[model samples]
Target: METESLVETLEAAGLSPYQAEAYVALLELGTASATDVAEASSVPAPRIYDVLRTLEEREYVETYEAGSLQARAHSPSVVLDDLRSRANRLEAAAEEVERRWEQPELEAGGASIVTQFRTVIERAESFIEDAAHQILLSTTVSNLQRLAPALRDATERGVSVRVSVHTDDAETRPDPTLFEGVCVEARHRPLPAPFVALADRRRASFAHHPDSYDRYGVLVNDRTHTYVFYWFFLTTMWEPWETVYEATDPGLPTEYLDIRHLVRDLRELNWQDAPVRLRVDGYETDTGEERTVEGTVVDVRVPFASEADTGFELAGRVTVVLDADGERVSVGGWGAIVEDLEGTRLTIVDAPTVE
Candidate 1:
């Protein structure tokens, strides 16, 4: 496997470029003077003193009176152990700040999220409140399934917890409900997303994907971001309890059925080039133009958020996937052709099932 990204790993492990260089040089040469370290590390002699000082404080390097200040590198494991112990202290400090202080401008920004899955659960559990209006969160199944307790604990604390899940394997036992003070429902949707957390919609957290060794997340406490996502992208389900089966009558257009069934048919018929179907709820309040909209996926270019850069347009036909209430949402052909991708939202333009 490729080694960790050197610049990122060294910085994360608490090393300045100069310090990291000095340590690596010491490791290479066994023991070296400041001048030797400077040469080996390619750090200038003037900056080497500051780097050595920081490394010494972090316990990654040791220095002695050897004819002009010789420095020695600590073992990798030793350096990491110290780094971790310091990290624990820092985490404790962060939790205290997260609790005791209202604003933590002085606290380090975005460094102390727990990495281990169980540890993340424990951290969430620790922060959970017993009041009714506590935290509101949504989770994908790929995550949180292992440490399902986080959801349960939040609910047990009477926090309003809303959950949506996507599953291809419908054969498993009914997944246990993870909350008590709130609603937990199971529904199938797209690939579960990572890093979705909103607390009371006033403060939100984004889960940054973990490093390859251990998965982790970054928490964003931005409220505007939370509000935008809540209104637009991360929609919580407001639907019926039972599975709404399709009508047996052939009068309806074939495209307006549950997308699960359509994908099944595609796989069953061995149609290698089937268009990606749009799963849409019927629409009302239209000029009847959408009634004849094709359900087949088409090529449409979607732009990334850029003005100067030519953007990504989804390749697919315009089709109405879901037309519930006033809004409609659909997946554009992922690689469609379009002049600009920035403003394009709907992919499959369509009419209602019946006017």
Candidate 2:
């Protein structure tokens, strides 16, 4: 087994079996004459000189006395150092060649199907690492566990990460503890089969075999296809699942952020012509005093066409609340809608199903 391993290693390193065996024999014997090396290594006596000479040329062996047949194996340290140096030189040359190489342009609407499970996971990880703005992803609980570390790393780098997980297993439900500090938000729903990841709305991948060990998937780069997938994620996978976790930065109160999401839910529900039980607690426009309104949403409008209407252009005083009669009031000036609405606790009842 040792001899076979040595021969294989030597062959991999560009040495012939005879040269490797001869070198190994010399190393074992410490020092030997050419005839002794051939007998010990089982090399044919006639060809031993040729093998030794080749090893000598490669500095794997050194003839002690140039005029005589005596030879010694190069010190293992010396041989390893030479090999490392050669490898580093080759790597540098490769980098230079790669720098000059031109990649072929990939035309739009081309899709590549990968049948390997590892390949799909590798592509998902690659997209997560490359994401700059946000990641929209849905998979099973086990799969989320597999990707949690990469997702955390991306979040730490200031990339936003939103994940939806489907779990049939009762023992695990997309453990948010795994991504406690890094993930921006995460939710759990029934298994959203065919795991998918859409990054920055630019790259997308969909698995055909999410539940099986033998997973097959398609990696898509076409913008149009990715956008379609993105909408599917937003409407189907992301919007329906209850948000199990949300990590907000220091500036905004956690409750304030909650209001933002709930308000968005209300807006979307209203847009679908569904009844919503959303109530807001804030200063009334007429009385300039704290008030509460609880009823079905009549209309939620963004009255300020641009920042110029608010005079504080960057403040983003865009959120306007209206009842059934078209009565409207600004929650917060420009950018502080949710924060402004949180003068006191606001109760938003569970949204009615949009059928």
Candidate 3:
């Protein structure tokens, strides 16, 4: 392949070009002397010792006898561990950059802060190969180029990886062929955005700008609802590319809508029976902001209900302040999915605030 890019990529993996070159050369030429590594890496004979010294210190290579230094790759398991090590370092470095960004005087256009983003991509690449459960990705040809290996790996692991393949070639795009042998499916959509990967619906890494992709990206792992949007967006793109239908009874109990809406709007206190002056003890199931909202409930799904918890399906004409999550809501969360309906009355501890 391209040695320059490979060297750059290895550098990204915490190797110096000299180290990358010398090691790669060793792999290509088999155990070699300092003279060999110097000639192979194009480093001057005098500087080869310095590069070898550095690589040797990092356990990337070993030297024995003057003029006789040989590079050795850590075993795959050890290499993977080492990969994770650098990823952790990059994560910490990125965190520091983010902390610095919070500084009042840390303005843009100074120092560029590009290295921080490069570390983010590094973090994403490290975690991508190990992705499990689900893979939510947004596409850009360039960003996907960096993520291809991870997606392929996830697919091989049998993870349900769904991708947002935004391309101009709508019909011919996605090249489903690209993922045929793997578990991942590349779907096409219209997003003029760089790549984003949400692995296992937990952590997410998204590129900021094309030119600066190698310079900066953000890694939001366990961040509040980053993956939720990623999942929602992926679902929106992939849900109905094909058509299907299911039948439901027209008349369902309001008790069902009550809990569903409450959970949906719990963050903003959209309890139908109440207003905003509510207690925090009434933890929001919705996670949206609370305020006075007058509108018809549009849609809802109650997974479980009993005498203590009124459960039913509710849908109607509607409008309300959507969660900061834009306009997507689908009974999301791990709150009690199935509750007793003992009282036959839905609970509302308080109402929303009068805006």
List TM-score per model, in order. 0.30, 0.53, 0.36
Position 323, candidate 1: lDDT: 32
Model 2 Cα lDDT, one tens digit per residue, 184-242: 77877765456888775567877764557655677776867876776677666776668
> Candidate 2 or 3, higher TM-score?
2
Q: Please give the lDDT score at residue 294 for candidate 2.
A: 56
lDDT for each candidate structure: 0.45, 0.64, 0.50
lDDT of 2: 0.64
Candidate maximizing lDDT: 2
lDDT (Cα, tens digit) per residue for candidate 1, span 1-355:
1222554456666676666667767777888888888988678989988788788887778888866888887667877776688789889989886654332221322224443444444333333343233344444455546435555666666444554443334453234443222333333334334444445433444443343344664343344454554443234321222322222234323431122223333333333244443433222222211222224443221233422232222222322233334334343221212211111112223323322
- lDDT (0-100) at residue 83 of candidate 3? 76
Which is the winner by TM-score between candidate 1 and candidate 3?
A: 3
TM-score of model 1 vs. true structure? 0.30
lDDT tens digits by residue: candidate 3, 160-234: 565566554445455445544443345566544455666644566666545543545555556345534454554
Task: Compute the lDDT for candidate 1.
Answer: 0.45
Clashing pairs in 2: 315-335, 316-334, 316-335, 317-334
